[model samples]
Target: MSLLTTKEIMEIIPHRQPMLLIDTIEELEPGKRGVGKKCVSYNEPYFAGHFPGEPVMPGVLTIEALAQVGAVVILSCPQFKGKTAYFAAINNARFKQKILPGDVVMLEVEMIKQKGPIGIGKATATVDGKVAVSAELTFAIG
Candidate 1:
């Protein structure tokens, strides 16, 4: 029910700079859904060696960001108090575009199901309205 910046997200997820892909979460509905953002930078360490002059965000990183966002949605649920969410699986994941430095990609995730210690979610990454990646991810909370 509120927006969270990386600082707030860090409090919940235990991720930090360099490894923390999400810069801010613009939307949050506890367990139902959430939207997060990642601002790619030209000075990122990866860009220095990602291709010399062409710096494309790694595709796997996008998926990780989405999964982390999805984890936030699940972990933030009131019912999940004192629990930790860990990704267990990923399905039907696809990447369609090249994400570059200076781009602000949006990550959105929707909870599909929650059963006991396991939860499922659908996630998508977009840049300027174009779908860059998507997947169905499952997580476990205990």
Candidate 2:
């Protein structure tokens, strides 16, 4: 019942159309972790230039999508609701597979550490049971 729809995600994060990477949040554990979904479509504006004919999801955008999911998780923390979380770092980023249009990526994020004003987290994106991207991210939240 607490699932976050696109509208709710919009309220929690500043990202919008074309940049808004998350389509839904199926689970949220304040100060702990989260699970989100993004269904890529052929109509995405970036698809055209990402490839001339054989469009492939960019590694950076895939990581960004994962980060956006992490952002939602950070904001869901009871103490941080209504605030913004900024990216501080993303380590060990890896793109193991190519993500194409029409793939529904399942993004999962887990909070690993929260100290002072910074947070450390890990995120991974999977499509069809295969990992497309993964990274450890750190954020400085105000």
Candidate 3:
């Protein structure tokens, strides 16, 4: 079950196909935190050029997916509705596992600190309960 479907998610965040990495919002807390999911497919455009026989999801895109979840969290707030969240910084990112096609990635982001238009969150992406990537992300709401 999903709290927000891809269409619903698009209504909240300004992302389109190819760039909209998350497939669903599994859990949400408005401006505080959220859990998202991505169902990786071999047909993904990047998989074409990323590799021929051995394809791997890009680490930066994983981070971006996490950031989009964070953006959904922030933009869901009544005060910030219809706004955009831009990356300010990404710190201490670690990619531990290769995310392959057909894997379902669980994206989680928890707001750790925020003041005015700037905020920071602790983000992590996992596949089958194994960590694939983790980072601290900072963003500015504008």
**What digit string (tens of lDDT, one per residue) describes model 1 on residues 1-142?**
3489778898788677687889889998988899999889897777887778889988888988997898788888777765678889989999999899988899999999888879899999999999999999899886
Alpha carbon lDDT of each predicted model: 0.86, 0.88, 0.96
Q: What would the per-residue lDDT of candidate 3 be over residues 45-119, giving only the tens digit for each residue? A: 999888889999999999999999999998999999989999999999999999999999999999999999999
Report the number of the highest-lDDT candidate.
3
- TM-score: which is higher, 2 or 3? 3
Off by over 4 Å in 3: none
lDDT per residue for candidate 2 within 5-97, as digits (tens), equals 999999998999988988999888877899899898998888889998988888898888888888898887778888888889989999899
| Strongest candidate by TM-score | 3
Worst 10 residues of 1 by lDDT: 77-86
Lowest summed-lDDT stretch of 10 residues in model 2?
73-82
- Regions of model 2 farther than 4 Å from truth: none
- Model 2 TM-score is 0.95
Q: What is the TM-score of each predicted model, taking all chains together?
A: 0.92, 0.95, 0.99
Q: Which scores better on TM-score, 1 or 3?
A: 3
Q: Show pairs that collide, candidate 1.
A: none
RMSD of each predicted structure: 1.8, 1.3, 0.5
As for candidate 3, its clashing pairs are none
